[model samples]
Target: GGRTPRIFKIMIKRVVVINMEEINRFLNGRGSISSNILTGIMVLNILIHNKPSKEHIKVGRVFYTNQGSRSLSGGVEAWQGYFQSIRPTPRKLMINVDLHATAFYESDSLVQLVVKILNKRSVDDLRRIHDRDRTKLEKCLKNLKIFVTHRGE
Candidate 1:
């Protein structure tokens, strides 16, 4: 069979360098943190603290609590388990995080969180997600805003 093959072009957009500080300021004000902001900060905190190098982090399944923080189990080792679960995720993929609090208990949230991390995103991307997820994303961004702008010693 000597049929001519048609070539298809696939374009991959280059990821520009993200200035975290500049992004923080543009999304929210310089000061103050609300409950939603707290949630946003928590989300960003997970992304920032888990791995010092961005390359090593994978925003896999993310979990969250609506009212309070997720409870830690089995001491520090749980964090190790947490990271292991999300390791297989690809380098950068945006995710929807309007998951209910119960999903955290089921370990699905970790997967979602990984999706958020690998994608290199801010709350603006939340525009494409569900309304509830967008609300949550906005709040988390607000929270992250406070942390980035703080002038504490």
Candidate 2:
């Protein structure tokens, strides 16, 4: 057994057929639409609009990058991002875009991040970090994605 085929089975229990005219009328508030159809359309819109990008990190509807980073207290950096969504209106779909601000850890070593967060002069200051501060540091560093740079030795 070298490799196993990864396949999933999903079954749609019911199908409702509605004409474009009916959908248009419903969208215009002339008629009622099913919740399932509305949910499917919303999910489809999200998938089409949120395809992954190499340069941007997407979390839910917000997209951000390392560019234009502003340093904040405790080694946290504020990044400017944007939230985008497509909504169906009376006769057309409207794209809504809004500015968003998010906080990220500054690019630095673990020791440096700890030092900044604890307001310490150097690693030596961490030798006697209080339990409360240690818990704070744990929460801050938890689930943080770190990249290692290797230099030829």
Candidate 3:
């Protein structure tokens, strides 16, 4: 099992040091948004959208979930998720959300996953994977995030 994560609370005093004239100009569409303001808004979006959730797995701006998972191919499954962001318009700010989908490896032993991916009946029948199959497996597992529990996380 994985260990529980610790949460820390921090208190920050906000000090408004932005130029009102520039902000007004940007809001009125007379000028472009400043880098500092954009950066601050992006950071705020990250903090707000990343609230802890036991039902979803967040990866950057996308939230992947098993709620509507569907078997795609072999050991891979398609997961439905969403991407959320805060966008500022000339008149007001809006929260933009959209649906997203991606493939995820099944949560199981690597050997089992390999068996499924290769369409094998059992691990005992496998001696070694062919070079072509190895390449295919590498492509499928590339950049896949994994959680290790053998060492107790």
Question: Any runs in candidate 1 off by more than 4 Å, and if so which?
Answer: 1-127, 146-153
Query: What lDDT is reached at residue 96 by model 1?
Result: 31
Candidate 1 on 1-153: residue-level lDDT in tens? 898999999999954444444334434555343444444545565675456344332235433223444444311012221222211122222333333223222133433442363342654653466566556545544533122233454
Reference-based lDDT, each prediction: 0.39, 0.78, 0.76
Ranking by TM-score: 2, 3, 1
Clashing pairs in 3: none
TM-score of 3: 0.62
Residue 83's lDDT in candidate 2: 73
lDDT of 2 at 146: 82
What TM-score would candidate 1 get against the native?
Answer: 0.16
Q: Which pairs of residues collide in model 2? A: none
Write the residue-wise lDDT of candidate 2 on 4-70 in tens digits.
9889999987565435565567678887777654765676566656553445887767788788889
Please tell me which predicted candidate would have the highest TM-score against the true structure.
Answer: 2
Q: Which has the better TM-score: candidate 1, or candidate 3?
A: 3
Q: Identify the leading candidate in terms of lDDT.
A: 2
